[model samples]
Target: MTRIAVRHLGPPRLTAGLDGAARLDWDAHRRVHPEPRPLTAARLVALAEEGRLHGRGGAAFPFARKARAVLDAARRRGRPVVVVNGTEGEPGSAKDKVLLCRAPHLVLDGATLAATALGATEIVLGVTDETAAESMERALAERGLDGRARVVRLPERFITGESGALIRGINGRRPVPPGRKVRASTKGVGGMPTLLSNAETYAQLAVLAGLGPRRYGSVGTPGEPGTVLLTVTGSARFPAVVETPAGAPLGHLLDLCGTRAGEGVLVGGYHGAWIPGDAAVGTRLSREGLAAVGGTLGAGIVMPLGRGTCPLGECARVVRYLAAESAGQCGPCRLGLPDLAGALAALAEGRDAAAACETVRRSARMAERRGACAHPDGTARFVLSALEVFAADAARHVDGGGCGRPVLGVLPADTDARLRLEVDWSRCDGHGLCADVLRGLVRMDEYGYPVIPGEPVPARLEDDARRAVARCPGLALRLVPRAQRGS
Candidate 1:
């Protein structure tokens, strides 16, 4: 694939000297980190404190706390392990993958630095995309870490990159949240302390180590130093991964990408909030900057929902996708999300549009803080932000039909197809047995026939689905793939 354009709005740290499609080899990586002084645990912590380094993977979590926790845990238990989260599962975000593919050695250098400082026994790069995987492999091989460091491929599911899920996958278990909090700082891979962080987070650390606190803190706001890598997509001259100083005006970056903020912009990723186009003009791209403006810099995904499309329809589609992507281990995932998606869909379709907004709000509240992962909460945040930003459009859609616009899918998604439960009408009579087997997923219609959701079946309900399919007397009920669903 051709390399994405890497533009710089202010001084560039992450994307420096790299143009479109240029992969940095070992030599280039060294220039970025020349004879890096090995950091003592305390010194690394101090540096992190000075720089105020934060994770680039959506959450904007402080990197110092995570590192300190791992250090304390290691001191009490044993040396920690370093895991570079190259598994970019968010469809709207490509910063991590771009770093992995274009600046592989820089990422490796950061991981190696952390590993050495912590006296880590292992280093693993968990990658999802094939291109990223190949690039990581080459970087490791070039550094002669083939024997020491390992690269593992992970599934492309959205929540698989969650810290707990990532550690679980590295531990030879399914890459899903353990239905409970599993702190990687204390109990991680092989039940040892693990310093798990996003790829860009590590790359930032490498930069910090090389540039030190004063030089690193020279740019951006004092609260958030250095540059941020963002995947800017939609309503643009070109969709590209951009690097800009932390406090740089959000509008400048949008202009650099040739974006026309038709409606408001969807700041962050699918799980992030939206900002009004006017509010975005002077908004900062940093965590503090965006937060002050009531938006998130999640996973560094910035997409402007341009005109010529229905904003509610676009949001509905994303809400449905988020609901489908749920880890399926929580009540919110099993019930609340689907309900919320339905409400949003109803509003988008102008079916009882007035009530649908209220329904959407209620569902979002119900879905909050009740999930194995942030999927539900993030999904809720996404929809609620939409409701707030597009209140006028929603009023029109509710009072009238739609805004007389098409969906036009400006947002990117893995699949537009919803998982559907189907029945073979010719095979046999209506069986209420399927409804009995799957309680929440399948129900009975006016007739005795079963009515199942066209939304994707909850991952937690796979057993129930199989049971329903197996117990069918005439083998009439079956699970239909999206490819078969006419929708």
Candidate 2:
């Protein structure tokens, strides 16, 4: 795994003095950031509530409310299991990994505090990257907390980072969101209620515990107090994770990265919406602030699109990637994502302009709110926002072929080149079950054989699509996870 460079702006709360350094040991970490003050479960909840602290994770859920629920559930069931979700699945986001790698001790401090508050002893730190896992393990050992805290290397899938999915993976299940609505807080690992928050959430908790609510609330917006770590990538000269105060202007961050906002910026990751760069300059980086500008600071990711790259092409490529990253569970996500991706690709390639846009709009409408997880909704938001934000470029695509620009491929498509879906031709008996179940993806060829899309099956339809495969008389359908051929 490649090492991500870390940096910070303003007084760094989570990433102070750790920038330019590889890893901060327990001693070094303590030297910089003060030790977390002990807090009872009630006190921690009170502090979080007072500070208006939100989860650094994309959902931006109230940390206090989530923690209180876990505590309540744990009291009723069994000791709660505290999980540090270091499985940073967002391709464009690197702040979690930065914390896990550079400030593992800080993250551990927060996790241990939360665990102690809930009277739980075990800390299960979930990391996707092997290096991050090792860093966490070493941190635990260095702090003599290795026995209490265990690091589990999890599957590095997009959906696996979801709280439920992380719990499911830790419980030795496939790293996918549950089909039904099973709250991890109520029924989590080992049938016990779990306290699962991402690595950044724990780190922020540590910061809050150390600084106290009043001091912690000094920097950021009134609604969302404290700083946020952002993985500033794309078009930026130095694409490092920078800790910035909440509600900072988008332009200030752009200036720090030495990136001029060209077409627009993709705030949040691929699941996030796109907004006009000029208009985004004044947009605040907080969740509420960005929401005011019709965008979200999801996962605290900001990617600028310089004029060198074709906006349509870049959007199409990322949409294709999002389609491939689908969990492949529900019908709408499976069929709708690829349809939307295809429409975007068509628009990018300057083909079937009007029809492609129409298909994209229709697919977005169909895909939104149709999946068990938020993948479909998030991806739909991304694509739909692109159409609205880049209206001029979209019109050019619809009216003519394109803006006559090449796909610089600024956005990462490395995962897209990894895996795809395939069919066992000999096993297929033309039962047409898969075609019927996955009509959005699978169709019957002239010979009654199921025709799977050449591209990877959108992950959103994995569950139902798998059911269709199971019902196949010949067991012909299989979703290939890793890439077998070049994208």
Candidate 3:
């Protein structure tokens, strides 16, 4: 691996006022926090641009740019809606959930500001857990923000947390991506332009609103200004959600968590990449800093793998879980993920080791850029990086019987692959529209019962798949994400 040297700085902006205070209610919140600025769209955009604030969501998109887009669209299309996405779907991530629970008022303040900027009278908050939802609701009532804001309990599944999926759920449809490109800034819930961002982003926005541009930009690095919330877990003594400035030293944070040099670290999350344990030390925690070390600040997740566990076995288990979590609307994600997972499992168990390893590599390649979303591609990256970072251990699995270690299963895969695609036998008149619309993903069986590929439809072809679904005359074909469906 190449050595990229960079200086590290300490982060103190976001966590500055907390002082270890956990869960601040309305009264506690107002005590320390200052009054937010009287926000207009232009003022918010200027402040965001000056602070160089980025979304805390996995994508790390420019918050100012996104806000501008939504505000612009609203100018032409009347008042838009604002959505605070508190649904933290990434298993390794807890920052959003924590912020929603502990500092619900801060998040709501940001949402209220954003709603005002967008000329939106309604603000909807999407939360996956009961605690977050309740906290938000109480904050709304206490602030006399009722009628203007609503709390929605979103599905706890992984993929359902996508912005598009959240919009679908808000529209009273199944919480899954529409299998096509739909910009939330242009057409979101209730078919109106919407401004949606993650919980941490809203909190940061609240802070920025209170601090203004200069004061907010005082702490973090030049390129990535402001603080970020990170969920540091796995093998660490102090496994908790932390707030730090953007450019804090990765080594310093690891030391605080009692992580050492040899223990492997998984930066980002399950969908993130793995790097050599020592490679992370001294590196900065900003997006550019992590990228310099061949990692991303994805959803602000950093997990350490202790030397005791078998890396290959651990990788295999995660691959399997990711396979099972597929939305089943994308063929490449559905089929390729399971195939890669099977290959990884075989490699871990020392069964057909060389062949399985090759299959895993091949399947990962085929799955890349083939899904409706980045799920398959991200899963592939995680597994492939594991194989590279733990090459010696991988060799042991192939050349020797196995690593002779236990699978710790330290990574969190809370949900099962209970979600599947089901065809209604009674509704099918066998018109074959399903097969005709989605070419490679769906086929016609002998009886003309649209033979659904037991795999996930690739994301690239999701629009066609959705078209096939919409054109189905019998209404027989339906995409089921889990065995037990929710409204």
Candidate 4:
């Protein structure tokens, strides 16, 4: 693999001292910041409109529209606050972490420029990881921005990365979102309207500021110009961050990463779908391109599943992991994920195929769009995509005892380990005390032990989940906060 220096300030570098350096080398860098021009509000809006810069935070909302919303709302309700969201809690995805650790100054440049344009004074760099927080802090200090921006290390839970949840965490509350629809751009930290976006999006803004609309429009497709950073993991030779022009061919990327001949490629991270290796023949790496293949450029994570690992087994492992990560806020996700995990386990162990498939389908339908957060929906997406991409494997598992391959466990263990609530099957009896305490979070299975969901507990329901944790009969259930859990 290539040993490239992953600096956040500019292009690839060799000096390790430049890892957290603050000097903005405008002329040396390639795409992110080709020049040192300050991006004004009008210029930014124009560039956003021209480049069609979409939010890289999975939602894919138009950047121009979001800016306008914040601008309009700020005009009506005084000034706004710029929030650079570095709280990347998604498992199996490390693009944000890579950017924050390597090129923090680029991200800060974007945040500062955006704040300047929006006429905002205060800036909050919301991060989940300690290393990222330190890197960003160092970058800020290097630029003498101690009082201008504050770096807040948020709870590293999956749901805590949600816009509302991050806002709540910044406001000195647990990193869980309220049940209501609260837009951060309207009422955020300190009751000030906040313009929040992913760390990479801000870095892109810095790039746009440096390279104007027309020059920036010259690299990628007509609509979405510039390059996107992708974390290519699973089965690829070089499992690192790759910078590719938007709308670049998927095949080319796979070749660059030395992806072995595989069954399919998982696009858009865990929440993303899979496409047949042949189907990705001419696929481009853009929102429209991914949409054409029934996928998305979600946070730009692409993983190639090789032929050695049992696809069905890997799917089961991922589904179980996703179920365990649920916040346990809504009834559908909290009650349904464990059942779904059980069904998947059965299928992976060569059980009833029809029953397993039905369970997965039903669980996905129930979980999708039914949670306070998108965790359930994303989990469902992962499961459904597995069903679509590995149909043959599912069929094989149904007929034979197994797929004749090992599990390999390539998805990600951090999320699974963090989210899993171990139950000693040999423990006394099915008291169902945990279920009684944490209503929506834990439900009594046939053998009890309170099967919990994979999503994060909603802000309002956290107290109840905690109560269940406290009242576990066998002391089997433990709420492992991400920080305590060492994620």
Q: Which stretches of candidate 3 lie over 4 Å from their true place?
A: 1-13, 16-22, 261-263, 416-487
Candidate numbers, best TM-score first, in rank order: 1, 2, 4, 3
- lDDT tens string, model 2, 1-487? 5766676668888888686568899888889887877888889899889988788888888889888888889778988889888898877888998888888998998998988888885999988888898898899899998678798898777887987788889999888778887887888878888888888999998988888888998999898889999998988898989889998888898888888878789998888989888888888888878888789888888999888778888888777777767676777666788678767787887777888888888999898887989989998898889888889988988888888888887887556243355667766778898878875456565577765655555545567667886788887666566546522
TM-score of each: 0.90, 0.88, 0.83, 0.83
Across residues 1-487, which tens digit of lDDT does each residue of candidate 3 receive? 0111111225444444455565677888887676586688899898888878888888888999999998888888778999989888877787787777777888888888888877896999998888888878888998998898899887777777788889998888888877897899999979888988998898899898888778787877889877777887777776767777778887777777767645578888887888688787887889898888778888788888888888888888777667656676788765788678767877898876888889988998899998888888889889888888898898898898688988787776555343345678788898988766654345565565665644344444556666777888888777665544423
Q: Kindly report which residue stretches of model 1 are placed more than 4 angstroms away from their true locations once superposed.
A: 31-33, 416-487
Q: Scored by Cα lDDT, where does model 3 land?
A: 0.78
Q: lDDT tens digits, residues 1-487, model 4?
A: 1133231212332111344543333222334344356666787777778777888888988888888888888888888999988887766567677667667777877788888888997999999888888878887787679998999998776667788889999999978757776888888888888889998898787777666777776677887887787878888876766777788888888777777538888888878888877777579999989899888888688888889898877777676656555655666557777667667766777767777778878878888887787777787887888788888888888888678999787766454232334455566366888767654345665554456554444444556666766776766666665334323
Clashing pairs in 1: 58-299
lDDT string for model 1 (82-104, tens) is 99988878777888888898888
The per-candidate count of clashes, in order, stands at 1, 15, 13, 13
What is the C-alpha RMSD, rounded to one decimal, of candidate 3? Answer: 9.0
Best candidate, TM-score: 1
Instruction: Single out the weakest 10-residue window by summed lDDT for candidate 1.
Output: 412-421
Clashes of 2: 15
Candidate 1 vs 3: which has more TM-score: 1
Candidate 4 lands at a TM-score of: 0.83
